[model samples]
Target: MNGSKDIFSTIFSAGTFQMMLRSATPVALAAIGGSMTEHAGIMNIGMEGMILMGAFFGVLGSFLAQSAFAGLALALLVGILAGLFFALLVVRYKSDEFIIGCALNTFAIGLTTYLARNYFPGDASGNPNLPELNLAFLDRIPGLRVINHQSVLVYLTWIIVILAWLFVYKTPYGFWLRASGEKPDTLRTAGISPKKMKWIASVLCGILCALAGAHLSLGQLQGTFTDNMSNSRGFIAFACVIFAAAHPGKAYLAALMFGFFEAIGLRLQGFVSSDLTGMIPYLITIVMMVYVVVRKQRRKMKNE
Candidate 1:
């Protein structure tokens, strides 16, 4: 009993909680990105590629320019170009989104791997790291103070969450975005372009996903670009989107749940094998997917 108690305490300790916040940031941001495209009838499986590229470029820019902001700017530029290219293929050229997304993932891995091997050529590259902001005003707060000294992106993510919620729920563009997915013909009848909405959604998704990558490489990883650093976070974000029914706020909460499990997994590494511990977050996500399916089936029966 005491052993179990200690294990639980170790997993839920303040340090673990702090790691959870950092772990959740990238996933939450990606979930928000995925939600944008999902609501606009675009299943963006390409976020994985975008994130990989963004992390690579983020590190590249910071390493070269010695400024995190420069890295961020470069990443966003890549994101914009990626979004437009994806739109041209999936929207204009009418290619299969799934195929294109898979291609993107493959392309990113190859490209980043080549660049890393030829240029960075190491386990990690530590550039001018992102600034860690101190919440001095919250010093008096007990538990909150512990998390006060996180990266600037952590603070920015909170504001982005609020803005994303407001933008998706309380704005006219939000209605049209949703309408484009559900009722494109109706939206067209109202003199709105469904294609334009989709294009915009793709671009927004790319930007957010790029930001997620920046947070990972610069904010969390501290300007290190590892091979496959994204580690399926994009897919996890996609799961969050479906679990939350494409709602950004709820998706963020779902990401936090996954992040908590990831932190727990990291904490358990000493007690278990690294491989097994690493599976914790993915296992939790799979379990959640099953629960979602069961709940939907029950609801369907009730409605019938």
Candidate 2:
């Protein structure tokens, strides 16, 4: 009992909260993109591949150009190209998104692994990496100051979150995106092609997922690519979409919830086995998904 209390105490500290924000950044970015695709009526499950590719390209661009901005630009370009490929197969050809997504994931792993073997055979730290945003003025503030220093993308994430929320709820395009999924016929009457909307959404998902990968590779302290670096974050971001019903802000919150739990797992490493600790985020994901289903069932029963 005391041990559990001690663990909980350590998990809830400010340091852990800061870590939670850091860990949640990638997930939140992907979740936002997932929400966009979800609202557009396409079941995009290929984020895993997109993220992997982005991470690989981000590092490669940085290494070759010796500039972090070039790395980010490269990641974005790759994302656009990947999004177009996905749209061509799934949107244009009417292919199964799940199958394509799975294929994409497999291709990403094989491709990135092969490239990593060739390009990053050894030390990769000499290349420039994405720098963290250090707010000198915030240093004077207590409490918030400690957590203020994070990846530039981390700070940008909050801005993205706000813009996403605004874009979804306050814009004509947002209505069209949601309508394309929920009321395609109605959207068609308005003369906006649902297919066009789907293509746009898919590309947006690709961009955001790519950004997530870039952040993973260069935005964080690791600042390097590893084999299979995405590590199921794509799926977790999808879970966040479901848990939040495709709401961008809510999805971010869900990602934070997962991040918090994962942070706990990381902290728990000292107290327990690494294997058990690794299960924390996955376990929370399962619970969240189960809860969504249970809630839906309960709502159905109540209506009946």
How displaced is residue 207 in candidate 2, in Å?
0.8
For candidate 2, write residues 1-304 as lDDT tens digits: 9998988888888778888999899999999998998998888889889988988898889988989889999999999899989999998999999999999999999999998889888855556788877888887887787477788888888888899899889999988999999999999999999889889988888899999999999987456888899999999888889888899999899889888877877777889775776667677768878888998899999999
Clash counts for the predictions, in order: 0, 0
Cα lDDT for residue 144, candidate 2:
81
Model 2: ten consecutive residues of lowest lDDT? 123-132
Task: List residue ranges in candidate 1 displaced over 4 A.
Answer: 122-124, 273-304
CA lDDT, candidate 1, residue 19: 89
The Cα RMSD in angstroms, rounded to one decimal, for candidate 2 relative to the true structure is 1.9
> How does model 1 score by TM-score?
0.93
The alpha-carbon deviation from the true structure for residue 298 of candidate 1, after best TM-score superposition, in angstroms, is: 5.6
Worst 10 residues of 1 by lDDT: 272-281
TM-score of each: 0.93, 0.93
Residue 243 CA displacement from its true place in model 1, Å = 1.3
